[model samples]
Target chain A: MATETTQVNVLTAEDVLKNWQGHRRVTRRTIEAFPEDKLFQFSVGGMRPFSEMAWEFIRMAVPIVDGVTTGKWEEYKGSKPETKSELLRLWDVQTAALDEKFWKIPPHRFSEVDKAFGQWEMPGQATIQYAIDNEIHHRGQGYVYLRALGIAPPHFWERD
Target chain B: MATETTQVNVLTAEDVLKNWQGHRRVTRRTIEAFPEDKLFQFSVGGMRPFSEMAWEFIRMAVPIVDGVTTGKWEEYKGSKPETKSELLRLWDVQTAALDEKFWKIPPHRFSEVDKAFGQWEMPGQATIQYAIDNEIHHRGQGYVYLRALGIAPPHFWERD
Candidate 1:
């Protein structure tokens, strides 16, 4: 009888983080592509302005990482930025925070089930993936908004 | 000396398929949410109507699967379906074809770099991931369209 084997470790923790950051880079470009005024004001088809969507990403992203690492869920209660520069500044800060805290999570924790923010219950990996997927979803909306405004959004495939 | 062991097989082939199909189900609902007249004509901010985006997905998705399985790349050149029912029928058919061809791909091939359609070059897994991500991206636009039309889109989180 022949023995069968499964391929393991197709992706590493580092790979996951880098993949997410790649998407983040593209999202940052999406932010920059917007006219400062339109970033907060322009919306399509009753969708929230891109800035509001961006705030959603900011609120969920680093907080989720923090919750995953420290097992302390703190709801983000920060005020929305009134300017694109302010928003970008906060985005940069959280991006740094995300990198710092993401490393503190042990490899084992990613597979363990936990309730993020004491609400959504899922494995840690799914929680992280949801954050990424949500960003991509909103970014798509941003793209439509940009096109409507006669601006071309960043290329979706240029994640890096 | 202590040895460090890496976790392997965190996700299996089946998990990947189920994840993609879950997104597909939500996208299918997005199709159903549209009024028949608006399904092909509605637009937001100069973006393509939902039907056109759906055609883009149909063009890229299963053909990529076929290319992955057979190592033959043929561009999808079928004409767009004019009616929403015709469109949904094609969507369902492709969904079945996707499942059928997805499994024919060997696990090892997923990690190999190949140019899908002789253009984009990446690992087979990334290619497939792009297809799913692209769907989510366009579906986000569909959500905005639905809301603009005073129709509620499907719950994005209800991917199961």
Candidate 2:
């Protein structure tokens, strides 16, 4: 039998945005739970500190939203925040920008393949999934760091 | 103007399975890189060891595929493997099972909502995303575990 192909409605654009935002909420709380000294300085098995990973997120997410309007990626030129609080402030600013622009993406665009950030060439929805997946993956490291530092990390299911 | 409601075909069911399987490949490699004693015994900030988290993955994934066909979630009753090799064997077996059964899910079923394992009520596609998302989240902790052990982690994007 020839392999079958059927178009499937996996998720709505709204559902996608909500899930992404929900996870962002959880990751922000995970950062707040970290001790400042350790958050900036600690490394496990040679991975960078959570503070470093946090920057990757801000850099990546801002592009996802900005690319929606520009379709051209701009390298993050802002200086890296030296402290965790400053990191959170930058994150909040990007979050607000995402909230404003994400809804404007017309539904048909999600299925169209586009080059993201000048390198990634994938469907729009896949790019969005990448943002969420990348965050969840990094925050998991933060949890391990917190546990190592004797702090209880936020529960995985608590995305509020 | 009333906002449009279109059931966009963002990802085909096959694409979903391929992505989930790809991540599993990366996660399995992550497990192999961990030292045996630390895999089971090490916990930072009081989180359970990577071994315990591995069990959660097995428990969750098998049910997701099995429940897809049987509509009944079977609690994983297999004895927990104490050694990493045995754990890999169990994972491979489950991977085989998932590979076979995952395709049996009709494409349209993905849009239907059901109580997965009689607990989670969500669209079938979202349930699959849950399985993938959960694995990515936990494997991140495994990365931290390896880093803390002074071992190099398998790169995040390597999935074969």
Best by lDDT: 1
The digit string of per-residue lDDT tens for model 1 on B5-24 reads: 12323444565677789889
lDDT of each: 0.81, 0.78
lDDT by residue (B1-160, candidate 2, tens digit) is 1145233445676677777888888888887887888888986667778889888999988788767655676787789999999999998998888777776766556767888988888777777778888899988888777776777878776666
Worst 10 residues of 2 chain A by lDDT: A1-10
The alpha-carbon deviation from the true structure for residue A34 of candidate 2, after best TM-score superposition, in angstroms, is 2.0
Clashes of each: 1, 8
Off by over 4 Å in 2: A1-6, A106-108, B1-7, B106-108
Report DockQ per prediction, comma-separated.
0.37, 0.54
Write the residue-wise lDDT of candidate 1 on A13-66 in tens digits: 555576788888988999999999899888876678999999999999988888
User: What's the true lDDT of residue A30 in model 1?
Assistant: 90
Q: What TM-score does chain A reach in every model?
A: 0.92, 0.90
Clashing pairs in 2: A44-B147, A44-B148, A45-B147, A45-B148, A147-B44, A147-B45, A148-B44, A148-B45
| Per-model TM values vs. the true structure | 0.90, 0.88
Q: How close is candidate 2 to the true structure, as a TM-score?
A: 0.88
Task: List iRMS for all predictions.
Answer: 4.8, 3.1
